[model samples]
Target: MILLQLLFSFLQVGLLSIGGGYAALPIIQNQVVDLNHWLTAREFGDIVTISQMTPGPIAINAATFVGTKIAGVPGAIVSTLGTVLPSFVIVLFLAWFYYKYRQLKSIKAVLKGLRPAVTALIAASGVSMIIACFWPDGAVSLNNLNIESFILFAGAFIVLRKFKAGPIKVMIACGLVALIISYI
Candidate 1:
């Protein structure tokens, strides 16, 4: 029953999330943070950051980590499989459909409409993560805001976007600076 619950929870995440791993953050948050209470908001934020720093896709990493946290190895396997299964099936189906009807006007229209929605989901996930990082208790806790973290975030954003720095370099630089700050 626990395994079934885990699988069903992540299955919904896989089926509902449209854009990709990052876009699935909100759905995962709703389930893991808001509903099931498997992880705290701060923990969820940390999970996301750790997932980003790691090699694999964020959603799968999140599913595996959360499942492991909940019920050890078997939970991790079930959750990861649940999170990936719908996407795997959908991709296979879409591959066939796209190959067969690559120029269909209806399909083209649907794809075009999906672009903005996916962007919105990704942006919303980013904003929520930022909020979670800034205010661990809740987004309403303005007094707990960390100015230095915001400065670091702004610096990273500028370096990545304006200067067109590579993400790996930016992350390394940020981590080094954070380490230095800890010593000071």
Candidate 2:
């Protein structure tokens, strides 16, 4: 039963997560954190962080992690499969469709129209993560702000944008900094 639930939830995520892994964050959150109660918001945030640090797509990583947490290895397999299937089928069909209609203005317009929506999805996900980081308890007050999290975020952003550091390097640096801070 839990396997079925994992499959179904990830199937929905796979089918509707149209833009990319970042854009799929909110949808995945809805299914796992909000709807199923499979993971808390904090755990979801950690999964997102781990997903970003890892190689594979965020949605697939998240599905595997969430599934394993809920129902072990079998759950991970089912969830990962469910998360990938729709993308595989959709991309296969879309490739054929785009190849056949490569010159059509309508197809071009449709593709162009999707860009903004995808951008918005990514932005929304980023904003939610910011909120979660700043206010883990759901209250928006200065007293509740996570100073260490804010410092890590700011420092990482500066290193990535200004210093032009590689993402992996920035992530590792931040992890080390956070670890040291935690020990202090």
Candidate 3:
């Protein structure tokens, strides 16, 4: 019964989230933190971190993590399946619809419109994650900020933007720096 409920909640997240994986963050945060009480605010930040570091859609990774944390192996499987099932069905439908309507101007226009919205959602997710990382307790006050993270954020942004460094290189460099800093 708990598994069923978890699956249903994830399914709803998968089905309703429109802009993509990043857009799923707010919904996932709400469901897991507010509705389910499965993870605390700090743990939720860890969830976002893990989701970003993982290889797949953020929503699917989050579901798996949350489920595993809550109920172990069976829970992970059920939650992952729940999150992916919606995308799988939607992809099939879109694949058929897209080819059939490939030349439709309205479809093209809609796609163009969605591009900006998706970009905005991705940007918002980045900003939100930055805040969550620097203030795990949801502290909006500047006095409570994590200086190391902010410096890392600024440095990474400059390297990526001005120097045009490859992301993998940047991440590896940042990880090494963080490791060395922690030892000091």
Q: How many backbone clashes can be found in candidate 3? A: 0
lDDT of each: 0.89, 0.92, 0.88
lDDT by residue (tens digit), candidate 2, 1-184? 9999999999999998977867899999999999999999999999988986688989989999999999999999999999999988989998999899968999889979889998997899999989988887899888889898899999899888898999988988988998998899
lDDT of 1 by residue, 32-133 (tens): 899999999999999998997788988889889989999999999999999999999989997999888868899889889989999997899999888876
Compare candidates 1 and 2 on lDDT and give the better one: 2
What value of lDDT does candidate 2 attain over all alpha carbons?
0.92
Backbone atom clashes (below 3 Å) for every candidate: 0, 0, 0
Winning model by TM-score: 3
**How much is the lDDT of residue 101 in candidate 1?**
86
**What does candidate 3's lDDT look like per residue over 76-97, in tens digits?**
9998888888988989998999
Q: After superposing candidate 3, which stretches have Cα over 4 Å from the reference? A: 1-79
Model 2 CA deviation exceeding 4 Å by range: 1-83, 99-102
Deviation (Å) of 16 in candidate 2 = 7.7
TM-score rank order: 3, 2, 1
Candidate that would win on lDDT: 2
Clashing pairs in 2: none
After the best TM-score superposition of candidate 1, give how far the Cα of residue 150 lies from its true spot, in angstroms.
Answer: 0.3
